[model samples]
Target: MVFLKILMERSRLPVKNFKEQIMSTIHDNPVVIIQGATGCGKTTQIPQYILDEFIQAGRASECNIVVTQVSLLKCVLILCARSP
Candidate 1:
């Protein structure tokens, strides 16, 4: 889709430093720090990226993705708004 294409175009994972260092650290470490400016696509894009990769690898049902936020009300509101 158009959104996926846009995400791919702007993805920071393509950068060698980010891919090699940050991603590897995330894979190897129990906790990782991913700091970026607001609207930098960290929250939105990372989950989708992981989901897509999991699906592509035929492990969509087996994998569990947990996205947590501090604000429960905001999370509920966003989930409600996105629901059909």
Candidate 2:
């Protein structure tokens, strides 16, 4: 819960529009493109947001999130950095 709060604080995704726009479009459509600058929490918060929403709706078992990391080194670094 605390960790989510931290991620929410750092996230740049607009909360109001995130639910109305992004999440809804993701559910209603087959494909969606999110364009944003770096440090916008796209790499971290977005997936968490999806998972949280699904869990809250009691559909987490029906959802799957696949993250394809381009760089092994960067991926490892990110995982390490995010670890408490």
Candidate 3:
């Protein structure tokens, strides 16, 4: 219950951010480039993208989406058991 409560109370994350002063502007482009070595929020953000699309397309109630986090077993354990 505690884990669920924390996850529910946590803020919904925003979309990925592009580099500032970048030659390429994502403002006009739907596809934004977010570069990071690893362990970034890419996996977490993709679902938000899908959810937004579903809502924008008026299929939010119909969309049954499942997102998997392919991280280390230990990381998965911690996320599901403790935080979310």
TM-score of each: 0.53, 0.58, 0.36
Task: Give stretches of model 1 more than 4 Å off.
Answer: 1-20, 69-84
Candidate whose lDDT is highest: 2
Q: What's the lDDT for candidate 3?
A: 0.53
Q: State, as a TM-score between 0 and 1, how close model 2 is to the true structure.
A: 0.58
Residue range 1-84, candidate 3, lDDT tens digits: 997875553333332442233324533676544544454445555555556667998999986545444456568788789874
Clashes of each: 0, 0, 0
Model 3 TM-score, all chains together: 0.36
lDDT of 2 by residue, 1-84 (tens): 997987567654554346557777878988665655555556666677789899999999988886544576588889999999
| Candidates ranked, most accurate by lDDT first | 2, 1, 3
Off by over 4 Å in 3: 1-38, 71-84
lDDT scores in order:
0.65, 0.70, 0.53
Q: Count clashing residue pairs in model 1.
A: 0
Q: Where does candidate 1 clash, by residue pair?
A: none
- What tens digits encode model 1's per-residue C-alpha lDDT throughout 1-84? 998987566665434235446556767988765656566666666666667768998999876666655477588999999999
Best by TM-score: 2
